[model samples]
Target: MLYSDIADVFDRLEGTSSRLEMTSIFSDFFKGLDPGSLRKIVYLSQGRLHPDFYNAELGMADKLVLRAISFTAGVSESKMDELWKKEGDPGKIAETLMKNRKQASLFSEPLTLEKVLKNLTMIESAEGRDSQDKKMKLLSNLLMDSNPVEARYLCRIVTGRMRIGAGSMTILDALAEAFGTKEDRPDIERGFNITCDLGFVAETLAIGGVEAVKKMKVTVGNPIKVMLAERLPSISLIMDRMGGRCAMEFKYDGIRVQAHIDRDSVKLYSRRLEDMTSNFPDIAAELRKQCRAERAIIEGECVAIDKDGNMLPFQNVTHRRKKHGMDQAVEDYPVKIFMFDILSVDDEDMTLRPLGERRSKLNETFGLSDMIQLTTMEVVNSPEEGEDFFNRALGKKCEGIMAKSLSQESVYRAGSRGFLWIKYKKDYEEALTDSFDLVVVGAFHGRGKRAGKYGALLMAAFDDESGKYCTVCKLGTGFDDAFLAGMPDMLDEYLSETHPSTVDAEMIPDVWFLPTVILEVVAAEISLSPIHTAAKSIMKDNAGLGLRFPRFTGRVREDKGPEECTTVNEIISMFEMQAQNKA
Candidate 1:
């Protein structure tokens, strides 16, 4: 198939804000495409060559993309820059210039989807001294053969900014509509959530149908989407929800990492599936040294420690994220991995096992070392015992406690949030029990000293049911001048030309962003609002939950993904907790 068919679908998607329309449009096209070509087209639809975990980059910066457009369209570089100033989107600029190219189309070869993928793969692998030139030449070579529509998509894909307005969940909806029944959606989603690869899932579904996707299992190297915990108001509610008996573990104030260990290899992944083995080489080495099993997938928290081996604040461990001065950073931020749960052991999936059984296997798989140890957990049968454990965790400079269900059905549901596990933090009576991690979805232009930068950012919480981010607050406080000035550079990847279709916000801001950056935010109280979309119509008619006097907590949760941010259900629970406290 031609790449233009994919480009045409992207064009139609960009022209609409309705997700149902986007799904219908893509579904219609996907119904006719060959199964083998589904992988490339699916990845392109998501504006990527690989999944979120893999780190293949095309190295095409915005200026380089404009130069490539100038090279093949016969438009001067300065002229293309002028057009870019008028039209913010480089894809549009490429489209307009390629249409009026000085060179005739008769000399150009037909652009095929296979050719596009090959060039992109070469561009990703291009490195060394001549990489920048090679990337631009490869991009221009594609433009030389591309039509106006194909040129637009090529530039956008290379630059890593496709404004087609469809997210992964939207593509999932389209796939289900195209090939499988509505009942197959959950099984299809289970496959993706387990493997963390949408392209593979799409190809499997397209080729062998839904049954192929159902047969997918947990692989060792592939990072599983970490299962999440829900939040509750108080200890009594947790004990009541868990039938008065639960396993309480210390909620360490550190980075949540998953370690995949084999015979001689170890891979550590963050909550977002970022390869963090380089970030914490010591942790990787320790996990490898201490593992007794031939292969195991364990979850842990990487906590920084001081001279006396006491736990330090989460900010101290953030220094390890730096690429340079790693040897010195390791000496400064001496760390330990507190293993909590094991998902797989020796090629056998342990996620289906009950929590108690999984915990037992985790204990048996690894010998305890100074750097690797199991989390402190205790079984409690009453609210008083749970409260005492929570206090002890705080006394150890930890966040709070995690209460997990001890029932036989308490299996690890990857990429899910439920009452099987619940988190309770300190300050239960002071509005929200813990800080909320929200995604920056939109921003207002600055004024006065903050001029030419963002004044206030529109933050939103993820609505998992709808797969949409709903506005909850505007965060303008707690940012110093340095953080303010560096905001654009920090949030470069999420900048959007228009409001993303996956975001639901009633208030409009000067700039929009795709949900990507996660920030830790705190608020005085949760209140009902007429404009915000979070928890809309859940508590009352036409009123959504919003944060009052929300402020940044000076912590950028680089360890979390947008989907892993605080959810709409969490905000609603906080609101109810506040109400209960007042009562």
Candidate 2:
């Protein structure tokens, strides 16, 4: 298949903001692809050469990409840089320059999908002396064959910015439409959830059909997408949602990790599926020494500790993520793994098992030690007991208690967030019990002391049922002068002239955004409003829930996607809870 064909689809995808339409375009494109090319196309559609967990980045910096654009378009670096400043997008600059190239090359080769992917792989693998030059040459060679439209996407792919607005869920929908029926989507999604690789799932479906995809199981070394939790404001509500009896575990304020152990080998992955083995060698060694199973996949939190073995804040653990000074940083900020749940044990896939059973196996298989220990948990049958446990967790310098359901059907739903597990944090007990993670939909211009920066941000919560981000509050507080000054540059890539189709807001701002940046916010309480779009008409006619006195928490929540932000239903639940308390 030609790269232009993919570029044509990309152009159509870029022109529209509707996920259904994007999925339809991808489905149609996938139908014409060969089995061998399906995996490559799936990755390329996401502007990636491999699955995200692989972490083999193209490593093409903007300067290097500019050099590639200049070399191919027969333009100087300064000219390209000026065009980039004006256009604000290197892809557009590449498109413009390629269309009006000063020199016509004698050699013209049609870019193939295989060739493009192979060259991208080469770019990712390039290293040592003159690697930047080698990467530029490889990208330039691809651009030399690509037409203007193709060059646009090629440049974005090399620079690691697709800006297509199509997420993994959309691609999964497209795959289901192209290869199988809606009934087969669960199987396809299960395959992806277990493997955490869409390209591998696409290729399997193309070759082996839905049954083979359904046969996918949790392997020892392959990292399964970790299950996520929803949040409620109160222990009573959480206990009520979980059928009264539930296991409330201490919610540690640290890095969420998934450890995969296969005999002598152990690998760690972050919640985002980034490989974290090298960063936590001490934990890896502990897992290998203590875990009794020959092969296992367990999920836990790695909390940094003080010299006296006291838990530290999440900010202290951030230093462990650095590539440099790993050994010294580990000594300075030692961490302990608090195992919570096990997903797999040997040949058995524990994900399908109930949470109670999984916890039992986790406790039975892993011995408790200073470095490796099970999370502090207690089985509670009432809200009072749960609240007590939550208080104890907070007293121990932990975040809060995770109220998990112990029902027979409470299996680990990988890559999903539901009420099977709910988080009740320390803030939930106060007027604002929880901080919301909202996506920025728009921004207001600064005034007076805040001049030359964004004064406030219009934030929204995701409405999963409608696939839209609905307005909930405007954030103006909790930002320092430095953060305000950097707001424009921070949000430059996501700035859009038109409101994104995925965002629904009644109040307009000075500038609109693409609903990409996520901010952590806290508020006094949720109340019904006449203007906000979140949970509109659910509690009252023409009214939606709104946050009162919302303020930023200085957390960007970069690890979370827009779809993973606080949802409309959660806001409604909080509003109703507040009303009940007043009554």
Candidate 3:
């Protein structure tokens, strides 16, 4: 296929805002492609060359890209820099320059899809001292033959910002529409949720249909999306939700970890599916040392501990997130991982089994070792018993208790949240004391004491149904002077001048972000608002849920990803519970 055809689709996607229209455009583009080319096209459209877990990136810096643009398009470096400052995007500047090139290259030729993919792979593998020069030349040569519209998309793909509204779900929807009927969407999505590879799933569906997609299994290397739980207002509510008799486990205040173990080595992943194996080398070593099974995939909590074995706050483990001095950090902050659930053991897919059986496998595969142990759990039949368990957990400095159903249907539903598991905490029965994990989507400029820096941030909750970030509250309080000063260094990596396609908000800010950073926030209550888009039209006609008097909790929540933040349904439940308390 010609490169211009693909560019036309993305260009139209950037201009259109409605998700349905985006799906239609992608479905039309995906109709007549071969299987291998379909896979590559999906990855490229998502601004990626590999799956989500890969650590390598294109490594193209804005300054280097500007140099390449000026060298190839015959624009002055001064002019390119000026345009970059005003537009804040490398792709836009390239689009403007490529429209009127001052020089024509001798090697220019018509660009093709294969040519784009091959050149980009070469750019990604470029390394060593001369990598920057190599990247500049490779990209400049590609630009030498690209049309104005094609030049826009090529630059955007290299920079990892396509500005297309199509998310993972959008692509899945289009694949189902193009390959099969709407009934096949759930199976298609299940394959993606299990494998975390949409490109591969699209290829499977296009070639072998839904049955082949359904045959996908939980592999040892590919990380599955972690399961989630719903929160209850009280112990009685939790008991009622669980059919009055359930199993409860201590909810530790630590990092959520999912370890993939083979006979030899082990890998750890955060809740957002990021590779944390290098950061927690000590934990990785422990898992490998204590394994009793040939192969297994388990989930747990990694908590920092004192020399006396007392648990530390989640903030204590944040130091391990640094890129350097990891050996020293491990010595300074020791950790213990409390194992909870098992997803696979010895090549058998344990995800389909009941939680009771999964727990049995977890206990059998790895017992109490230096850094690993089963989570503390018990069976409770009444509210009184559940409350006692909850109190014991809080006394041990834990957050609360996780009440899980003992029913036969209590299977591990990966990448989903529901009432199969419920969280009962100290704040639920109190005056809304539980802090929320929210993502930063937009920010406003500061004044007076906070001049020349960001004063407030527009926060949002992850609406899983829509795969978008919806605004909730503006966080301005509970920030120290040091945090205020370090805002730019923390948030500039996700800076965007155009409104991000993944975020849905009625109110705009001075600056927009790509929803990458997660922060811990607390609020007095939830209220109806016209400005915020969270829970929009779900409860009321036009208003969405918003937080009243929201404040930061002084923690960055580095362990959690933006998609793992609090959800729209959780906020709506909290709002209704608040109303019930008032009555």
Candidate 4:
């Protein structure tokens, strides 16, 4: 496949608003690609030389790119910088320079699809450690052979900002379109779940067509990203809608932990599935010391408190989560483990086991040990009985109750939240000025008394499906006059004219921002909205979601990334829990 052909498709996709049109364009585009090359093509479409998580980035920044563009367009560095400052985007800056060039005629040579594909392959093999002189020379050489418009996207691709908007969902939709069946999507997703490799899925799709996707099967112990959920505000909401009686348990206020134990060692995984073995050395050491069985995978919570037994907040425990300084951090904020459920035991992946059996096996295998304790739970038959336990939990400084379905057939759904496990908490029910950690994505230019600085800013929730930011709410409050006055200087470093991989929006502010800064926000309540892009139509038709009467929480959450901000799934869980309480 030619690079120009891919780029042309990208252009059309970016311009179109209709899903049907986008799918049609992609179906045609997928026809020309073979399996191995199709895999490569998907990655290239996102301007990534390789998959992001396991691989190191090419690490090309914008300044070096501007230099390359200047060389290509025959412009001075000073002139290019001015254009960059004005446009706030390298691609835009390049476009302006290209337009100003004396020899830039309407009859300039156009880029062919073959040449674009060839260059993309070449770039994948190019090492970032190559000398700047050599790198610039290579770029300049490529530029001399290409026209200005092609050079514009080429520069953006190398710098990791293609502005093509070819997100993960785009590829998923494209796969479904090319394969010509929505029924095959589950199988295709299973392929990704096992391999955790989109490139591999794309290749299979191209080679076997939809039949390749149909060949995907479930594989146990592949270490997929586990889907997690928040506790609902009330257990009554969970039970009122159920057919019969349900089982209930306690909801602990602690870090969720997934433990995988082999013969020699035990590893801990966070909800994000990032290995935290180094972060919780004490937990690993204790698991090895206490466990009688060799192979097991369990889930639990880790709570930190003082010798006086006062529960610490989530923030304090998070401070001790550094990869290095484990010993010191453990000393500062030692935690107690409360094991709840087991997923596997003795070489058997028991995730499909009923909650009752899993609990029994977990109880039989690992009882309470030092630093490891079982969660306190009661077998309640009614929502009223569960409510009493929920109240007792709050009185004891616990989060709330986790109402579980105790039937022998209840299985642990990895990466799903059905009625099997539900959390009921008072904090979620009582409309607080609920605090949210949101990402800053866009900013409106200040006016009048606030001239030369930002006034209101656009905030977003994390979209895990696409790994991007979707606008949830706009915040301009909770700032004292002094904080507001000094906002521009603090935020200027993060200013951009384009959103990164995880940010998507229909409305562009005066300035786009890299999803870097995380802010603490307080809102009266969350409500459905059509305007907000975060969780758009995720709840009901034509209804997106956002926080109502949201104000700044006066906390920046500077330690976190935009990706670490509260997610759309979390918000939806909270909403569902609230609805249950009303019922």
Candidate 5:
């Protein structure tokens, strides 16, 4: 298929508001494609050369991209930088200039999607040791004389920022629509749950139809990609839910990490499955030295507090993740790896096993030793015991408690933040809560101290039944100057003209956003509001729910997505729980 053909379909998809329309757009286009090719098309639509877990980077940075932009658009480096600073995209800037070129159409080339796919593979293959120039040259050579629109997408492809708003979940929704299987979302999700690759899911749908995906099975050590999540100011509602005793563990304030260890070496991955082996070398070394089992996949949180016991805040742990000064970072911010659950061990995948069995296996494999300390977890018979532990956690400056079900049937479900593992924090029950997970809808231009960065974020909640994101809050607090300065750059990937399928709002922000990123928000309290869009008419009158004093918490929930954002149902449930307690 030609780039123009796909681009036309893409434009149509982007222009539509209805999910049904979006579904039709993709279904028609993909039905003609080979199953495997259709999958590749899905990945490319998101502007990613490959899935994130594979660590397939194009390895081209800004300076090299600037060189290509300079050559393609006939602009100086200084001028290009000026445009990039304002627009946050070199490709868009190049597009603007290319349109003005007298011979722009003459430069255009009729390229095929196959060529694009091949180029993507080449880009991923070219990595490490001075490949930036080569990558830039390849991109420049592809679009040296191309038209403005072509140049725009070419730059987007190489830069790994499509800016077309075609995110992973969007593709998932599109696939579901095309195949006419919202009822089969779970089957598709099962395919994804096992494969962890949307490309594979798309391909499976194309090749075998829905039946091919229905027969998928989970395999161990294949490293199925996990979907990210959004954070929530979890409360001690488990006590209310079960009306029975629950197990509680301190919700450590730190980075959530998944450790993949084999007999040879241990690798650490972030919740997003990004290779973070370098981030926590100390933990890696300790895992190798201390882990008893030859092979194990354990999930834990790392805090850059103290080895002795003092837990640092999430911000302090984030410092350990800086790429530069590896040795000093480990020394400055010593982290403690609190192992919670073991997913696999010694070539045996244990996630499907009962929690009781998994726990015993974990305890047997990694004893209470120096390198791996068991996360503080206890089985209790009463809600008061769990509540007492919750207080103790907060008293020690901890986040809160995680109430886990100890049933043998309770297994480790990755990519799922279900009631099986509920978190109970201090402010969860409060009307005006500070922390919640919100999708980033829009950002404001910086001024004064924030002159060159994002000032505030427009955030929203998820309404699952409606499958739309609803505006619930706007955040402008709990972030330092440094964090504020970094917001725009960090969120550049998510910037869009509309919200994700996970978002439902009548009031659109200046910029739309992909639902890929999740954030932990701090707010004053929940309130009834007519202006906000979340849960409109669900409450008394048309005054739906909204957060009064929403702010960004120090926590960056890299583990979540907008779908996992505080649900309208959850909010109503919490409100009801609060009223019952007060009464």
Candidate 6:
């Protein structure tokens, strides 16, 4: 297929903010693509050359892209830089400048999707001396062959800023529409959840049909999407939700790691699917030594330890990820792994098994050692017992307790957040029971001491019923100078000219953003307000719930997506609970 065809679809998708329309456009575009090229098309649409787990990025900086655009458009670097400053986006600058170029290439060839994808792969794989120049030449060749419209998207993809407002969920929706019925979506989602690769799933569905996708299973070395937990306020509510009996495990405030062990070979992945095998080589050696199974996939928490063998906070363990002096850091801050759950063993899928069965297998598969042990847990039948366990976890310097369902149907639902598990943290006893994970929807300009930085962020809660983000709070406190200074670069890709279709807001700020980044926030209380849009008309006519004195917790929920953030219904439930307590 011609690359221009894909570019036209990108233009249409970017012009509209509606996710449904974007999905429809993507579905139609997918239908026209060759089955063999579907995988490349999906990756390119995501501004990637491979699945996220592969992590082979284009590695093109803004200056590099600008240089390539200038080389192709017959413009100076200074002139392009000025245009970039005014346009605020390199993609747009390329589009505007390329259309009015003073010089034209003597020879041009029609660009194909295959050539574009292959050339981009070469750019990514380029290495060693003068590699930057090689990458610039390759990108310049593509720009010379591309028209102004195609150049716009090409630059965006190279610069890692394909702002089409479509994420993995939207692409899955499109894939279901293009290759199978809507009823087959769950199977498709399951395939993605287990394999953690949308491109592979798309190719399988396109070439081998839905049955191929349904046949996908957990494999060693491939990272499965980690399961997530929802938050509730009190032990009574947690016990009530879990049928009065549940397993309570200590929630460690450390890195969540999934270890894939196949005999002597072992690998580790973070909760966000990042490869961490090299960072935690000590843990990998420990797993290889202690794991009894020939092949297994187990999840655990890796906590840093002090010289006296006491657990340290998460900040201390984060230093282990640094590239330099890793050996020294590992020795300086030794770590231990507390195993929690097992997903697979010897080519058998355990994700469908109940939590009780999985826990049994986890206990049977590993031998205890000083470097590795099972998480501290207890079976509780009442709220009082659960609260006592929570206090015990706190006494051990842990974050809190995880209340997990022990029902027969409580299987691991990968890439999902539901009531199967609930997290009760230390802050629950404060004004609010749990801190909310909200999405950043807008930002207010700073003044006075905060000049040149964002003063406050407009936050929102996800409404799953309507698939919209509703404004709930304005978060301005708790962010230190470092965080404030990094806000622009962190949120640059999500910056938008207007509110996204997925967002519903009452008060506009100096800037809007797509609902992408998730932040943990705490508030003095939940109150009804006429200005906020969250839970509107449910509690009272035309009044929505808002956060009072909302402040950032200095924690970015990187493991979560915007759709998985705290929900409006959860907020309403908390509000009602608070009112009952007052009564």
Instruction: List pairs with backbone clashes in candidate 4.
Output: 2-113, 3-116, 3-117, 227-415, 232-423, 237-580, 468-502, 469-502
lDDT per model vs. reference: 0.88, 0.86, 0.87, 0.69, 0.70, 0.88
The estimated TM-scores of all candidates read 0.97, 0.92, 0.97, 0.75, 0.83, 0.93
Clashes of each: 0, 2, 0, 8, 26, 1
The local distance difference test score of model 3 is 0.87
Question: Model 3, poorest ten-residue lDDT window?
Answer: 426-435
Model 2 lDDT tens row, 1-583: 7888889988898888788898899899888888778898788877788887886788687778888888888887778778877776678888888888765477978898888988899999998998988999999999998889999999888877676767778888888999999999888998998998899999999888898898899987677877878777678888888888999999998989999998889999987677889889999999989999998999999999998889999888878888898999988899999999999998799999999899999988998789998999899999889878987998999988888888999999997888998887766555555779999999999899987789999999988766778999989999998899889878866776566666789999998888878999988888889989999999889999899999998887765667778888877766765666555
Tens digits of per-residue lDDT for model 6 on 1-583? Answer: 8999988888887788687898899998888777778898888887888887885789888888889988888888789878877776778888887789765577888898888988899999999999999999999999898888899999889887787767788889999999999999999999999988899999999988899999999999888988878777689988999999999999998889999999779989987777888889999999989989999999999999888878999888888777789889888889999999999999999999999999999999999999999999899999889989999999999999998999998999998878999988877655577778899999999989898889999999988656679999988999999999999988877776656666889989899887879999988889998999999999999999999999898888775667778899889877876675555
Model 1 per-residue lDDT tens digits across residues 355-474:
999999988889988889899999999999998999899999998899999999999999888899998887874656678999999999999988899999999999877878999998
Error at 162, model 6, angstroms: 0.7
How far residue 410's Cα lies from its native spot in candidate 1, in Å, is 0.7
CA RMSD for every model? 1.6, 2.6, 1.6, 5.7, 4.2, 2.4
Q: Clashing residue pairs in candidate 2, if any?
A: 427-433, 428-433
lDDT of 4 by residue, 1-583 (tens): 4455666677787665455566678777887776767777677676775654333344456787777788878888888878887876676676667667677545435555555556555654566567555556556556655554556667777776666545555567778778657787666765665344678788877777677766654332334445334454556656764434666666677778778777888778665445677778888888767777887777788888787766776666675578677788988888878888877778665666787788888888885665888888777767777778778888867867777777765776655556677665566667541367898888887788778778888989987765568887878778788888777766765666655544767667888777767888878767888778777876778777877878996766754445568888877766765566456
lDDT value, residue 286 of candidate 3: 84
Off by over 4 Å in 2: 102-104, 429-431, 441-445, 466-468, 485-516, 528-533, 536-545
Candidates 1 and 2 compared: the better one by TM-score is: 1
Model 3 lDDT per residue over 1-583, tens place: 7898888888899887778888899998898889888998899897888877776688687788888889888878788878988987888888888887765577777899989888899999998899889999999988888888888888878887677868888899999899888999888988998888889998999899999999999989888888888877888988888888999999998888999999788889887777899889988888877878888889999999999999999888778787999999999999999998999888899989988998888887885876777889999999999888988999999988899988999998888888989887887876563678999999999999999999999999998778789999999999999999999999986788889888999899999998889999999988999889999988898999999999999988876777788988888888888786666
Clashes of 1: 0
